[model samples]
Target chain A: MDSMMMGAMTQSMKSMPDMAAMDMSVLQACMDACAACEQACTVCSTQMMDCSPACMNCADMAGTMMRSMLRMQGMTAASMMAMLDACIAMCQTCMDECMQHADHSDACRMCAQACKDCMDACMAVKDMMMASA
Target chain B: MDSMMMGAMTQSMKSMPDMAAMDMSVLQACMDACAACEQACTVCSTQMMDCSPACMNCADMAGTMMRSMLRMQGMTAASMMAMLDACIAMCQTCMDECMQHADHSDACRMCAQACKDCMDACMAVKDMMMASA
Candidate 1:
């Protein structure tokens, strides 16, 4: 995410009662990861692979994470936590599925990496929240 | 989610660390909400309201939520919670924006309703997790 967009997101998050107090950088990274993962997974899913189901799911989860960042008003701390868990789960599942054919397909390899990155970002966000809580 | 699909997802989730022990029914509801909201938001976005940005974001988030449900192996409890938060946040943002036009547009009204339902489902998942923990 660019500084200007981050600024816009920050401005938006300020209205969310529970999110205003947290680190925006962490949130930004997670959102970016989600966006990147979505793109990668979308491209990968188009490929004919047995891992298509996982790719599709990862793409959806990543997209969700990105939009969630775009709109913070609906979130509470509890909901945010649950979302993070789901994203992480989705990524891990996708990564594992993609890994099975990573050697044969570059798309799967890249998608798996994106999923890993997304999982890390989500986990970082989770950790940050937990500390504050 | 059909019993067959849920059964497939359950079998997949067994490999995950924190999710195997969790309730699948709550997860399924959340996933279904995400899917419905995504469809609602996508159709609503074509309406060209000032709420378009919010609608776009909501549509993306709903897609992600749906995908996450399809692939359960990648999830962890923490990530799931965070994702739920993000989805709820996105839906709330879309709902609020769409509510501004609800009186004039049935699509916006329906979109808002979908977002609300999705938020409720996400919160239900979060509450269920907390009880388990």
Candidate 2:
């Protein structure tokens, strides 16, 4: 996310006292990871491999996770937590499926790594939320 | 999706014996609803209303749900059910938020209607799954 967008987000979120305290840089990292993972999974899904379905699912979930972070005004801590958990589960599933085909396909290998990175980034946000709570 | 894409989807899922019993038309309707809801939510989110966050979340979940159906080869009945439940919940939340501004915003009204229609379509698929299971 750009500084200008972050400033706009901060302005828009001023009403939410809870979100006002959010670390913009951390959130930005997570969102970027989600976007990257979504793209990787999207490319991997077109491969027509057995992992395609998982890749598609991961792509969708990652995109949602990224967008949700962008729209923090609509979320409660509970809803955010649930969404993060779902994203993590979807990434794990996708990573596992992609790993099976990693040796045969470079796309799957890169996608699996992306999924792992996204899951880690999401976990960091979850940890931050928990600590703040 | 058009008839050509539907035909292609059918060809791709030939390996899935369980999906062979699936009704393509019903699935098509559900996917269409999801796609429409996603588009509506995406537009609504950019409106920067209180509903924007929910709209963004709905857009992501709806898109994911639609793509997952397209890649049915990757899902089990259980995973499909979970995803449908998540999508329905997200749509209901978005619709509720958008309805709050329906009197003032045409976009919100349209997005709310799309969410409702998507929820109905998803429920129909769930009912079909239950019957088949």
Report per-candidate TM-score of chain A alone.
0.94, 0.95
Minimum summed lDDT over a 10-residue window in model 2 chain B is located at: B74-83
| Fraction of native Cα contacts reproduced by each candidate | 0.42, 0.42
Candidate 2, B6-66: lDDT as tens digits: 9999987777766677778889999999999999999999896688889988888888889
DockQ for every model, please. 0.29, 0.39
Evaluated at residue B4, the lDDT of candidate 2 is 97
Error of 2 at A43 (Å): 4.6
Q: List, residue by residue over A5-120, the lDDT tens digit for candidate 2.
A: 98888786778766666777888889999999999999999996688888888888888888888888877666677678778878888898899989989999999999999999
Compute the lDDT of residue B62 as modeled in candidate 1: 73
What's the DockQ of model 1? 0.29
Off by over 4 Å in 2: A1-11, A17-26, A42-48, A76-79, A127-133, B1-4, B17-21, B42-48, B76-79, B130-133
> How is the predicted docking of candidate 2 categorized under the CAPRI scheme?
acceptable
User: For this target, which candidate reaches the highest DockQ against the unseen true structure?
Assistant: 2
What is the Å distance of residue A49 in model 1 from its true position? Answer: 2.1
Candidate models: Cα lDDT each:
0.80, 0.86
Q: Tell me how many clashing residue pairs each candidate has.
A: 33, 0
